[model samples]
Target: MAGWMNLVNEWLVPALVLSSLAAHLVVVVLAAVRRREASGWPRAILWLANQAADLAATQTLGNLFLGSTSREKHLVAFWVSFLLIHMGRPDNISAYSMEDSVLSARSVIEAIFQIAGAIYVLIKHIIIGGGGGGDGRTFVLASITMFLVGIVKYAERIGALWLGDLGSIQSSGKKLKRASLSVGHLEISDDEQALQAAHRLLHITKGAFADYSSDEVEHKSSHANDEQARLAAARRLLHIARGTFADGNDNGSRWSWSQGWEQLFRLVEMELSLMYDVLYTKAAVIHTWHGYCIRFASLHFTAIAFWLFSLSSKDGYRWSDVYITYLLLIVTFLLEVRWLLSALASTWTYAFLINTNSGLRHAALCSGRWRRLRRFVMSLDLCRLALVRDPSSYRMWSGKIGQYNLLSECTHDMTSFYRTLAQRFGSEDSWKEYKYCYSGVLHISSPVRNILFNNIWDKLKLAYKPEEMRAMAAMPVPHDNDARRRNKLDKALRFAPELQDYILTYHLATDIFLQCSGQKGAACAFVKTIEVLSNYMLFLSVVRPYMLPGLKIHSLYTATRDALHDIW
Candidate 1:
């Protein structure tokens, strides 16, 4: 038993260090997968890797503190610095979801503890040790430099989380003032144009919807042609319209519609893609001034430490430990370089360059050479093309909506037991997962998309004012005095005051109609359209209550489910 314990202890720290490195590699490699519509396995793997990164690093640090088996204290101390760097996480990711940003306080506490542990490890293993080879001062300085770099990175992550928090977002909605320069004369590809436009219009989603105005907030450039500005404005308006709806803060909003349906659809997709970046990724941190500072500092300190370590004596350390140290240093340097390059080539940086004047730096960045270089870097598609063979197959969104039917759920019950268990003992997320497990998705066909767009477009054309847009949510049934005398729909409408009630009622009615129609009109595409729209409405009410207005829709769904089960 003692021999087994010894063996485990001997191999554990190195194994954990390597595991942590592997996890970091996974994170960096999969960094381009920012869309929620990406495969669930990649997301799941990324999530696990994110969790394992800190776990492996923290555990290894603990092991080192508890007296590691290695005799090379200096090498072990150097490994401690690398562990700290690992804990800071990669630049491309910070939160896996919105919930993570909200729980930034927890992350802060965890970072404090880890930083304390790292400092303790450094103090014990390097600062107090006296047996290393010639001129240990430079080695100690190198370790200290790497430690400072780790702290800066960790701070950057914490700041990112705080910046992305919902409360912070709500409070600082007016802080992001419009830039002075609009992007112009850039001979770029379609994807690059979309990225540039998204970055330009990001402020609409990032801040209060009430603050947006085309003339007041839009960045205008004297060099930009009038036709170009008009086209960009049209695209921006479409993006803002969807952004306002997705944000859900504004009760009523009006946006000018000039773009075609295709452009409008693509604009919505790009807007959502941008929202994902702001809410879930490190875009909030890496696009700002301080973000640039931290990236430069990280690269600078890493290079300095590498040089210092190489110049310092390593006679006393084991060859294996020395090789591992070199590996860690080289990897850190390369990652920092990659992150810096990514930031420089980003659309945000392009926007920044167009906006700012930094003397020689401004001239260099604005030059045609810099534009060509940026174009070249973007053409590599390092994040997307490397991971996915066919770029066309990859999209920011899957362009499918969840399909659910209240009657179908009531009739074919499968997850009732699991859902009950979840409600009784599990978290809110568990309950949601089980309750909605049976829901499927359907691609919105092109004809259906056109019909939906035309209906909304017709309504918007009539709704000149914001209040009229808000009123458009109501069922605009043309009041036929004769039909009103014949039917009791007024009473039915009163009974279904809540959106949930209306959704369920429509869903049941549609299901009944479809069942009765059978093969009679099944050949018609409109039949499928009716079924699809009904299921989608039910899906919104059941699986994604927050997307709808008002509160307690989940409770309403639960009550409906119970009543249906009892009737059954």
Candidate 2:
């Protein structure tokens, strides 16, 4: 019975060990192929090292179970040195090298250690006989120690792989977002141009969506329509603005663009909201996968460890039992390492999601503020029209004016709200805080500011009353030199052939407001407000002439010329 048992141990066990090692190598190779693009060199190195250890473990186990031949023992010792060389090292930062000199040096050192260990194992086995009993306690203790060391090494490798995956996902997401934003810049400036640009962007965005969706088929398809609708709405607004301007009814035409602009802005906000949702969903999926990997690895290691421990107890303290226990421990270590890596990957995914969500929120708030400002301008247009149609309709006109004033106040409140939110939720030093928190982007661009001022100027230029026109003209130019202010007045006159009389009226009205308020700055603010109105009128005048049938390049040029000449 003992002879039969020895034969089973010597032949059967070695063959099984060799087969397991081969399986591990195949699996590692497959995984490497699948993850090559995203996997860093460090991860690859660790994986290769693990495979080497498995190879060593197989050889060592075979030698112990078979008749502990000196050559076989020496081979096992060499593998130990190989494993030690990798295990003793700290992580390498750079993955790619023509030759890993450190690893090479360690390999040589391991060879020497392996020769020594092999000789020791061979001599002991020959003297005591292959089946000689040893202290079971020492063998069991050594097996356990080896098992733990293997586990630690495997855990480190797995952790590195998980973190690398997280980094790759984050980079892809950021690249997509940047592409979207680049497309967004097309929405700025003139209606027709902006519409065409937005349409092109929408097409590009859809293509990207299709590519990404192919990889993540589980994602809902609802967002596609939302993005399409947004682009369409923005284009519609541009068409309306062009139509209204061409009709020559400034107030009514402006109203068309205002409503369309509001719709388009809302759509943009919705698009941003959808982006946050998609990112969050992707993050959840990544986390789920990571958890699954951890659980699977843990179960695998636990089963192997339990099986080995059970057999070792039955066999008593023999070299073969010690070798089997060592193999089981190494397996357990590998699983534990995989779990650690999965956890780290999940953490990085969470960070990326949070960062993107915050950016989208900031964009939404900024769009909301712009929408409110549009409504305020529309209200003012209605009030002016009511007053002009019926001089005795003071009550009706006053109500409209009051509504307009309220809307203006609402816009200010919205600005304050955004400022508070930025301070609370965003990093103080981030670009979002700098651009949107205090309207820094709006402040820095003199050309855009001039455009806004021009729009406001257009409204003031249409004042029916001489006194009102005088009050507007008297409004100060905040940063304009005397020459610049005069130039603007000249430009306004060029757009509105009737503005020369209007300017005299505005100057008189300005004196009246100045006397009523002791504060000169208050008087200046009111004057600057009128200048803003003139700028708006200039914009309308330029846009209006181009709205006619048989639109020509000359017509466009004339409109711009009139506005620029008037402002200059």
Give the top-scoring candidate (lDDT): 1
Residue lDDT tens for model 2, 1-568 = 9999978855554454444454444443333232222123444544564455446543663455454444223223223322432332222211121122123446556544544444444345433333334433333333334433444443433333323232332334434543342321223343333333333333233323332211122222222232243333333332222222322332322222243333343333333222222221222332344444544554454455455444533332446635654564565455445434433333222333324557643553445642354334435446445645421122110110000111122234334665567567864333232332222211213443445535543532432223432343355742222223334444543534444334334433554454476543343544545444433333222222222212233344345335544544
Model 1 local distance difference test score: 0.63
Kindly provide the TM-score of model 1 when superposed on the true structure, using C-alpha atoms. Answer: 0.75
List model 1 lDDT by residue over 351-450, tens digit each: 6665566664566574665677666665677666665554322534555677777776777664667666766787655454334432344678877777
User: Which 10-residue window in model 1 sums to the lowest lDDT?
Assistant: 220-229
How do the predictions measure up, each by TM-score?
A: 0.75, 0.21
Tell me, by TM-score, which candidate is best: 1
Superposition error at 275 for model 1 (Å):
3.5
Model 1, residue 100: distance off in Å is 2.9
RMSD (Å) of each candidate, 1 decimal? 9.5, 25.5
Name the runs in model 1 displaced over 4 angstroms. Answer: 31-34, 66-70, 103-110, 130-135, 174-191, 209-258, 307-320, 360-366, 386-395, 413-439, 465-497, 519-523, 551-568
